[model samples]
Target: MSLLTTLNDDIKTAMKAKDKETLSVLRMLKTAIQNEQIKAGRDLNGEEELTVLSREMKQRRDSLAEFEKAGRDDLADKAKIEITIVEKYMPEQLSEEEIRQIVQAAIDQTGASSAKEFGKVMGAVMPKVKGKAVGNQVNAIVKELLQEN
Candidate 1:
């Protein structure tokens, strides 16, 4: 089934199971996907839906970090729950070591020998790794590797 279809089905399942937290997160994801479709004046394709899922997941991670920093353990736990639910819809995440290797390959492929070409290298690499790795993580690894070279 398509991701959207699966999400809608899961929403019904969550409701039937009385899974309020999962249902809420699923509904939020549904809204985000619908909003994107409205904006584009067309329904989202699989790739576009994955983009929305990734964005939602990223927002939850950021929220979790802020909550932790403020010592709001309750809110942080809530954010973590939402993150876990949202992540169910995301492509499997690449590990740090795996991402670092891919980033290095991208750099080599782009012939980016210095930090000055960071932007160019990133542009080349982001598309290649898009659904597999989070942007900020990939960016940090790229920066560290580029700086070292």
Candidate 2:
């Protein structure tokens, strides 16, 4: 089934199971996807849907960090729950080693030999790694590799 279809089905399941937390998070994800579709004036394809899922996951992660920093354990726990739910819909994340390998390849492809060419390497790499790896993590790896070259 398509991701959207699966999500809708899961919403029904959550409601049936009286899983309030899961139901809430699923509804939020549904709203986000619908908003993206309206903004684009068309239904999202797989990649676009994945983009929406990744955005939702990122928001939860940011909220989790902020909540933890503020010592709001209750809110942090909620954010953690939301994050775990959101992560279920995203693509399996790439490991740091895998990301490092791809960044190295991007550097070679772009012939980027110095930090001065960081943007060029990032532009070449981001599309290939989108949703699979976090941006800052990939950026750090790229910077470390470039500095060594």
lDDT of each: 0.89, 0.92
| Per-residue lDDT over 15-109 for candidate 2, one digit per residue giving the tens place of the 0 to 100 score | 99999999999999999999999999998999999899888888888888899999999999999999889888888999999999999999999
Model 1 quality (TM-score): 0.94
Clashing pairs in 2: none
Q: Model 2 clash tally?
A: 0
Q: Count clashing residue pairs per candidate.
A: 0, 0
Give the per-residue lDDT of model 1 (tens digit) for 42-121. Answer: 98888898888888888998999999999999999999999888877888888999998888998888899898999998
Show the lowest summed lDDT stretch of 10 residues, model 1.
Answer: 125-134
lDDT of 1: 0.89
Misplaced by over 4 Å in model 2 are: none
| Candidate 1 ranges with C-alpha deviation above 4 Å | none
Candidate whose TM-score is highest = 2
